[model samples]
Target: MYLQTTIIAIIMVATFALASWKLKSPEISMVITAIVGALVGGFGFPSRLLVEGMFTYFDVGMIFLTASIFINIYSETGAMNALVRWIVKQFYDRKWLMLVLLGILMIIPGALTGAGSVSIFVVGGLVASVMSYMGFSKRRVAAFIYLFAMLAAVSPPINLWAMLMAAQANMPYVGFNVVLLVPIVIIALFTIVYTGTSKTPERKSKEHILSELPLPPEGMNWFKIITPFAVLLVLILLSKFAAFSIPVLGLPLTFVICAFASAMMDRKRWDVRKWFDVMVKTMDQVFPLLATVISVGALVNIMTATGVRGLLAITFITLPMVFIYITALLFAPFAQGALSYGSAIILGTPIIFLFNSVGLNVTVTAAALSLLFPLGDCLPPSRIVGRLTVETVGYEGSYMSFLKAIAIPWLFMGAIGLLMLIFPNQLDFLVVY
Candidate 1:
């Protein structure tokens, strides 16, 4: 059974490799892999199983999709622009504080949505513009955007890698807030400050900076901008503190509510038609992500049904501890590059289980592993976030140069992940569940 399942897993992986090579679509490649794996496992045309599997990440998909919608509406309403301008106006002279605030801004969307790509889309361009004015090279600007966006996705509340693994392991996705937040915050601050500083740090005049930024729409203010997020924060806090009294608005619904409030608060009111158009655009923007989530779910189910997951799990658990650590540090990102979030289920789940078996804290371990996953978003096969960052920042330098620019911070983030894995027990107290 082991040999057969191992071969089946190998074939499925080969199928994915071939399909991804030819198709250039991660979701399609994964779906094809699932179909092939099921057939090879002698469950030909297992329609019911395939369909059921697609729903595995349904909740996760909705969270990203809805959160993205809120982000889009917030951007559309000029709140995002006003907020960035406000930050620069207030703190551009403070250099380090401004960079930290900007880094935090870049982190917010991805943290809310659980995909770094969201951060790149919503704020990468704006942040890159600000960084450019600070006299950073184009490559460094792209690297900063890519790095914080990566950190944002790995941040708390919506870390897809950790959430995916937790769901698969039947672990409550609680107690991870502080465990994930601390290291990510540190890494983001360090990366931004490190990149922001140079031999001669150029501080653009405040007038020049404000002039470069897109003007906030007429009637746009911080109050308008702050209200929607305030609503979101209050709702989330209420749900946690007043669980029985409040209807449990899941993340998706909560985001939708925020999106609606954002639209309503718009100085330029969105007509129903405009809202519909925005929703449709949001769906179009998020379709690839949603598709990837569904395909990952299907692929995981197929692997489990064919016992491929078990085979891989057993193999990983039997490896030397040092080798396991090496794999987490090295392999996790590449797997993520190839398979996107599916890598978390395929690789992360097994590693988490293996660590848990040895008494490591699952929350810290998962958070550590998640840090590595985003690094892959900047690597090969499908360098989704990487490519987007380059395009967003208009980095005309060689891709290698961009990679080189981020190399230090990338390794720094990975080292932190490795340390977390090594001392998860020590860090376990950070878990606030």
Candidate 2:
């Protein structure tokens, strides 16, 4: 049984590594790997497993779809642009303040959408440009954008990986948020200090900062700029604190409502056809992620059905708790390719169970695991976020330079993960009941 399970694990890892290294689409790679696993394990019909996997994350897919549309509509309304311009104006001539505000701006979209790419493509790209014009190196700009976007993806109200890890551990999603706060704050401060203080080439003209700013539309009501985000925040708070129950739909409904509200606030009228068009475009951006999620489900089903997951869990149980914790911290990042959540579902779930079995605090372990996974977001070979950062910053194939820029932030977070592992009680105060 161990031999068979090990072989299955090897095949799965090889498939993921090949996809990451070769730049093959993760969705296709995962689906094909699932088929191969089923065949090797003699799991009967692969199609059944595939459907089961896809169905497992149907609601998550809906969230991604609606959230994508929300971001698209919100961006189209120029709210983000107005917000950026306003912040830059407020912090004008204050370099540190501007950098700090830029970091916060980069974080907002990802925090709302729970996708690093959304944050990167939506606002990180613009921030990169503005910072470049402000005289920061391409590498520094890429690092700043990558760090904050990653921070946003892992933080607060909509972190998909935290939600997944919590669910797998049978913990409430709300409960998990508090435990994450300390690390989030640490990483954020470190990022701001590190990137904000780095010396870069000085801009020839300070006036160009304002000149390069994205102007809000004519007759635009600046007050209305806050509406979409405000509404979304209120809904999220009400959902969490007020026990507000919107029957048959929850957060996804909030996303849809916010998207509509944002569209309505736009200076340009968006008819139903236009709304449909935006949604289609949003889905085009969202489908690859959705496919990857579903494929991960299929892979999980195969692992569980084949008894491989159990065998792996038992194998981990044999290790020293310290070794288990360290291995998970070091190895989980590489296990994550373009699919952070998928990696969580695969590598994270089993190890989480093992941690629980060995008497480690499941909540702390889960949170630490969440921290480690984002390292994979920019790790070499598959560096999806790093590549996107380079392109957005116009580093144009400077992947290595981008990696170098992000190295410190990555190591800092890794050290935090290690601390969490070593001093789990230090975070006990933040534990949710």
Candidate 3:
């Protein structure tokens, strides 16, 4: 049984690593994954293989695929341009203001949409040109954008994790977010102060900075730019209020709104056929990530199915909570965030249930996980934050310096996390969903 589960874990993780770290094709990875699953079942090499059933594998893929399609559609449409222009123009004159504002903007939409990579890429690319002229360090920008995805993790309206988990618990997401906003804000501000106000030498520019980064072609307007996203926001908020209920269409609904908005925004620049073509370009860049997410889900599902995840559960029992939370805190951005939120829930929930379940204190762990996961999302090679920030901002990918800028800021957050540990009940102030 152990052997069979291990095989699935190996196959699943291998596919994910290949797709992400190595930048391999998703089709190839999926094929490889299915083959491995086939061998595991057909040859009966691992007797326990069947235990990791189809439902687990299929559901993970569906959720991930559905989510990606939504993001993909948005990317293809070019609606993200308005957001870029709006943000750059607002922040160009004030570097510190831009830094804080960028983090805030990233947090709001990202949290609402649960679109981490997509949102970060959009913001990063748009702001790159502006940042280059302004002279912020690469590391600072990288860390800044890295947190860009994270701020969403805790923010309201979107609260993807909360929505996913809340459905199971039958709780109100808005209520949860409202209650925890203070702590989340504290964590977020800590991240901002840590990552935004870096120690790296500030590379202020001598040449007069431009009044604004290049706007999208003449036709784009703020209304056209934000209308789709606004619809999405309204729908989610209405759903929360019982005024309306949104379908569980994952991300497609939002993407559709954005896609049409994209067309509306770029009518002169691109026709329908050309617009659809942009999605293909988007897929070339994004599909692999979806594949990676699905593969990781498969691996984790298999592990849980085959009992390897149970082993990990057993391992968690031996470690002190401090070590667990702190370690997770220090390095989650490299894990690509958002996803780690799930892992922490799966891993931490059990311990909490084991220790004493059924309360908001579980939220602290969730809070701690929330804090850590974004850090993982921003780390390098994966280049979660820096790479996209540099690319989005239209630079030569020199955002490494921005990462250095946040070193001090990270410590400050770390300090806060450490302080939180002293008060056992304070964790409840963090969000669980």
Candidate 4:
């Protein structure tokens, strides 16, 4: 019986690894993994526990997806094109003494809308085309673009990551706040400075550069293009945390307002039909993620109800105290946060709980892991940011070269990790688990 339980657990973990390696739908694999685990764990495993966990995680995932889809629809309309186009012109034409500024600005699009496939298709395509013309390497370009993009994916207001963080820690929204943002910001700055210094000077002369850069909108106001995106984000934030509450519709109203704004962006401002269509499209994109999260709950429920997870937890805690504790903290994130942003956010919950049980401050441990394990969905292989940058004018290469470009950012993110571990100040703003 014990051997059967062990095999079930092994299959569950193997499912995650193989799913990612083969690039399958992780949730589907997890579902299959759970069924297998349930069979091996026997009839004693409580079905009610699995049902409760599934509903809880699934509902959480649903709320986030709903919020994001509402925002995505609002931002993707070409109405916002004017603002994006204007920013592009201004950024390219500006007098710049440093390469770091360019990198930092690159991530803005991903940060704003959310880094899902469709959004990336729109945002990354534009950034890549511009960087190609500007003599910036695509490798260098992808690095800057994805860092901010991933940051946007994980950050607050629309932070699906925060929900997972909260769920894992068994804490509330107030616990996360902007405190976690500090370490991330610190890492980003450090990566920029380090990466910029090593590269050869970027002197393409104003005459050469300006000619290549596109012009800002002729008559279009910047606000018109950006106002919808800005207003929607602001409205979402206000509804989420601000003390001033709207008595009428409440929190869901944030999505409603943003969706309305997005709908308004259409020059023709088509009928309700188009808006519904967008909502449908959003659902299509979100389903796989939904499935994966639900399956994870089932798997966890089975493991825990059978007493296997608790046993494994104790076994892990039993080794030499320091090494055991630190090792457990370290590997948990990798297991949970593997390449997909949605999955990482979903799985990171369990890892957070395990860390908290060990007496390490949940915030410090989470902060440390967040710093160490980046590249959730769209980052480099080694989790190193520097490997992704480019020294050459126009060159792209194998996976290895891509990793090199992102190398600096990885190092920078790591430094932040070290600080999170050692800094006494960590206790100050930390969300107690």
**Lowest-lDDT window of 10 residues in candidate 4?**
380-389
User: What value does the lDDT take at residue 192 in candidate 1?
Assistant: 70
In order of appearance, the predictions have TM-scores of 0.97, 0.92, 0.69, 0.75
- Greater-lDDT candidate between 2 and 3: 2
- Candidate 1 accuracy as lDDT: 0.88
Tens digits of per-residue lDDT for model 3, 335-400: 443233343334544444433342425444444444444555445445444455556544443455
Most accurate candidate by TM-score = 1
Cα lDDT of candidate 2 equals 0.75
TM-score of 1: 0.97
Off by over 4 Å in 2: 11-23, 204-206, 244-249
Steric collisions counted per model? 1, 0, 26, 21
Q: In model 3, which range of ten residues has the least summed lDDT? A: 46-55
Candidate 1 deviant stretches above 4 angstroms = 200-203
The true-versus-predicted C-alpha distance at residue 96 of model 2, in Å, is: 1.5
TM-score of predicted model 3? 0.69
Candidate 3: residue 366 Cα off by (Å): 2.1
Q: Each prediction's Cα lDDT score? A: 0.88, 0.75, 0.51, 0.52
Stretches > 4 Å off in candidate 3: 1-96, 112-115, 153-176, 179-184, 187-212, 243-251, 261-270, 318-327, 330-349, 355-360, 378-405, 413-424, 427-433
